[model samples]
Target: MVGQLRTHGELRTDTVTRAFATVPREAFAPGAPLEQVYNRDDVVITKRDENGLAVSSVSAPRIQAIMLEQADIRPGMRVLEIGSGGYNAALIAELVGPEGEVTTVDIDPFVVDRATQYLAEAGYPQVRVLLVDAEGGVPEHAPFDRIIVTAGAWDIPPAWTEQLAEDGVLVVPLRLRGLTRSIALVRERGHLVSCGYELCGFVPIQGAGANAERLVLLQSEDIALRVDGDQIVDADGLRNALTLPRVARQSGVEVGGFEPFDDLDLFLATALDAFGLLVAKPAAIEAGLVERSTRMGAKTALEGGSFAYRASQATSEDRTSFEFVVYGHGPDADRIANEYVELIREWDRLHRHGPGARIEVFPTATPHAEIPDGRLIEKRHTRVLISWPHLTSS
Candidate 1:
């Protein structure tokens, strides 16, 4: 697993590599096959909710390694893990060594009990396993050098920033405009600014910090729009718009096979005024109602009764390359389609290979004059800002 992580460039530092090598993952996930336990790309689900959704799991080793590298944990640094899975806590314990403190907290008592037993069995009895709401943070262990969140968060609570040390780093999978990225943020003056981020997904957080996305179903449970914030939409009109013809426009941007375009998704989420994720089931796609371009829903721009989403067409004989395309439907299909295509071209020209977007988080009460120019996503505790920098060749 360590070798695979190194080859993939996820395990960059020697400290994280050694932590992965030394920790016995099997001890945390007992009764699972050794092959499954060691698989770097698989997540072992440990607990589920009444709705059959995964509430807790031993996260994929690849994600674990990526977050740990982003964290840059040292041998004697105190770390707070917001989600409980015995495996990751043990790995953190190894990284922190004997002198440093490691506290793992979770709202689910079942998860906490399981993690405590597994950690003790795995010889990491010194690690503190607590059952508490992560929104409040572990105040008893305040002022941690590093706080790594394993669940998907919609906002940065005040307690987290208050509990972090002066020069601390908080690595969290934060959701913005319906897209989630594991952002590494550090405090500067009074606000937190992002240093780097990676695309990731995790179970939605529960408890006081839990914020659910609004799902507007267009066709029963198959086709829907996952919207964030108070962005109003004409649900009935959009549902009727789906029955109208779709207008397709080619953006003339070609991408090779297996190329990642998450940056483009993030760019569109910010550039557009109203955006949401268009989710559809296989039945809808098979019936020629939608395209199967992305497994995790399609990036969509909503304008009143009209909506446009991203799609692609194969440009090569062997289907090794694809061209970006936009599909729009509604009263103003042509205009929305062209608008979506223009943004696609702009991304290819300006930000396809640039430094990407810079994200920063400030207090909600911060004056508008003090904030930077960008898209502002208002959360309960913080105001998230995303700004794109222009790249110039030296």
Candidate 2:
């Protein structure tokens, strides 16, 4: 697992690699198979809600390693972990060494109790486990050198910044639009600026900071649009539009089979005026109702009675190369489809291989003139700005 993480560039530093090699992951996930516990990509679900949704779990090792690298933790630095699962806290304890302090907080008492027991049993009794809504952070342990959030956050809470040391780094998997990215941010004046970000997903945080996306169901429980922010969605109109014929347009952009295009998704989420994620089940794709683009939904643009989403089709016999395509439905299908295709072409031309988007977070009360020029996503607590940096030709 350590070698795989190192090879994938997730575990970059020796300190992180040592922590991964030293910690006993199986100790935290008792009763699970050793093979499963050691799997780098699998998450050990420890608790679930009445709805059977995962409420807590030991996060996947890959994500853990990626976030740890992003954190750049050093010995003697005080670290506060937002979500507790014993294993990650133990890893952080190891990274920080005996001179540092590690505190793990969770909203659920059951999680806190289990994590406390596991930490004591796993030889990490020194790590502090607290029961509290992390939205407010652990005020008693303020001025932390590193604040690592282990859950998906919709907005940056003021307490997080207020408690963060002036030179500290806050690593969080922040939700922008409907896409989630684990960003490493540092305090810049009164706001946070990104040092780097990675594509990731986590169970949403529970409690005062919790914010759930509004799901607009189109076809019963099979198809839905996951809308974020204050973007109003017309469910009835979108449902009726989906039944109409789809207008398909192909953008000459071709991507190799193993290539990743998450950056393109981020671009579309920012470039389009109104955006949401188009989620569909396998049944919907197999029934020929929607194209087989993404299992977790495709990036979609919503405009009144019209909607368009990203789709792709194989352009080679070997199926190793595929061209980017857009599918539109509604009264303005042709117009939306053309607009979506043009954005894809624009991304490929200027930003595909260049520096990706620059994301910044400012307080909600910040004036529009004070915010940077870009796509601004307003939340209850903060306004997120995403701008693409210009690249220089070598």
lDDT of each: 0.92, 0.92
Query: In candidate 2, what are the lDDT values of residues 1-394, reduced to their tens digit?
Result: 9999998888999999999999999999999998888888999999999999998999999999999999999999999999999999999999999999999999999999999999999999999999989878888889999999999999889999989999999999999988999999997877999999999999999998889999888999889899986688888889999889999998999999567889999999999889998888999989988888747778998998789999889898988999988999999999999999999998898888888889999999999999979999989899999999866678
> What's the TM for model 1?
0.98
RMSD of each: 1.1, 1.1
Between which residue pairs do clashes occur in model 1? none
Q: Which ten residues in a row have the lowest lDDT in candidate 1?
A: 288-297
TM-score per candidate, chains pooled: 0.98, 0.98
Q: Write the residue-wise lDDT of candidate 1 on 1-394 in tens digits.
A: 9999999899998889999999999988888888999999988889888899998999999999999999999888999999998889899999999999999999999999999999998899999999999999988889999999999999999999999999999999999989999999999879999999999989988899998899999999889999997779899989999999999999999999677889999999999999999998989888898889534789998999999999889898999999999999999999999999999999998888889899999999999999989999999999999999876666
Model 2 pairs whose backbones collide? none
Mark the 10 consecutive residues where model 2 has the least summed lDDT: 288-297
Q: Give the poorly placed runs of model 2, Cα more than 4 Å off.
A: none
